[model samples]
Target: MSKFFTYLALGLLWLLHWLPLPAFVAIGRGLGWLLFWLAAPRRKVVRINLKLCFPHLSEAERERLAKDHFAMVARSFLERSILWFAPEARIRRLVRFKNQERFDALVGQPVILLAPHFVGLDWGGARIAMSYDCASMYAHQKNPILDKWLLHGRTRFGDQQLLSRQDGVRGIARALKAHRPFYYLPDMDYGPRDSIFVPFFGVQTATISGLPRLATLGRATVLPVVTRALPNGAGYEVEFGEPWTDYPTDDLEADTRRMNAEIERWVLTMPEQYYWVHKRFKTRPPGEPRIY
Candidate 1:
């Protein structure tokens, strides 16, 4: 039954991919409107996250932002078929890189492409993998058939490698040592095991400290990467910022805070594009209440 549903969904995505850009955008917005009204659980999560992050905004303002966010999220989901299964030339034309030289300079060095969870994140990864062999970690899906398809779609370009989260950091470290850049998405709540309570939008959020540790282990440089979905189906822009001069400092907690601060800055630039549907503050510190 699960396999049947998965195939049906995949078939729809394949058909959607054939639509023109404007038609795709229109359909995605319609779907997002439906979801905003129908998906109560996810809408509540987004509302909670926005309220926690932006206390200054009035209730009505936050609600407006939440609606816009839902629209972008739906658009990202529908457009992913292009990234996953579209022709190489089509994907190439759709994703543009802002600072290609900065990324090109890290050819032989251990590097981490620190990408936050923006709506166009997967598109950013696909754009990078078009030219470089990068490594990234992915959570396994329960459905085996879906998992295999995801793994194949993400790594089909540039001989990229996708490591399972269960494989531990050793695979990523090895890939880094072999001079492949790590496409590290380090902005999620993975519990409080190796995470420390840090100030994210003035909230004590549990953020993973593995980023600094991984960089230290691989002796890699950290470069911030951001992707923006252009308006009117103009395509995506993947911008690679300058490498951090002094990162992974002696203070792991401080380093994690700095990482969160950077993500906050980016989120402010485009609040709608940031991944707000996630329960980021789910893992609270001891003696504290859950935000979600």
Candidate 2:
């Protein structure tokens, strides 16, 4: 049954992939409009997230932002077919990199590409893998068929290694030490273990401390990378920032806080593009009420 559904979904994606970029953009927006109304639970989640993060915004402003966010999320979903199945040349043309030399200098060196949960994140990862042998971890989808397809799509270019989350830190560290940059997605809520409550948008958010630990273990430099979805189906731009100078300091908690703070800065630049539909504040501190 799972395989049947997975294939059915993939067939729809393949058909959508054949549409012109602009046409699909319109279709994706229409899908988002439907989802915003139909997926009431998810819409509520997005609303709560935006309210928590941007308290200064009026209710109307937050709602507008939520609507835009849903549109971007939907576009990213519909565009996955292009990222996963389109010709390599088409994918390359659709993604542009800024300050790529910063990334180029890190090749063959132990590095951690710290990517946040932005809408265009996969495009950034795909762009990086086009030139570098990188490693990253992924959570397995419930459907085995979809999981297999995702793994294949991500690793089809270059010598990319996508480890399962169950593979643990040791696996990722080993890959990084082997000179494969870890395309680390460090901004999700994965519970309290190995995580500390840090100030994210002034909220005590649970953030993972593994980033600094992994950097220390691999003796790697940490570089921040951000990808933005250009307006009007223009394309995506992946920007690689300078490597952190004094990261992974003696204070692990402080390092984790810094990580969250940096992500907050980026989110401020484009609030709608950040992954707000997620229950980021899902795991609350002891005795605190649930935000969701």
What TM-score against the true fold does each predicted structure earn? 0.97, 0.97
Q: lDDT tens string, model 1, 120-230?
A: 998998888888888999888888988877887788888888888889898999999999999999899998888899999999998999889999999999999999988
**Please, what is the whole-model Cα lDDT of each candidate in the order they appear?**
0.90, 0.89
Give one digit per residue, the lDDT tens place, for model 2 in 1-292: 5668779999999888877677767887888889999999999999999988999999999999998888889988888888788888998888899999998888889999999999999889888888788899888887788888888878889998878888888898789879988899989899988889999999898888989899888899999999998878888899998899888899999999989988998899899999998999999999998887
Q: Between which residue pairs do clashes occur in model 1?
A: none
Pairs clashing within candidate 2? none
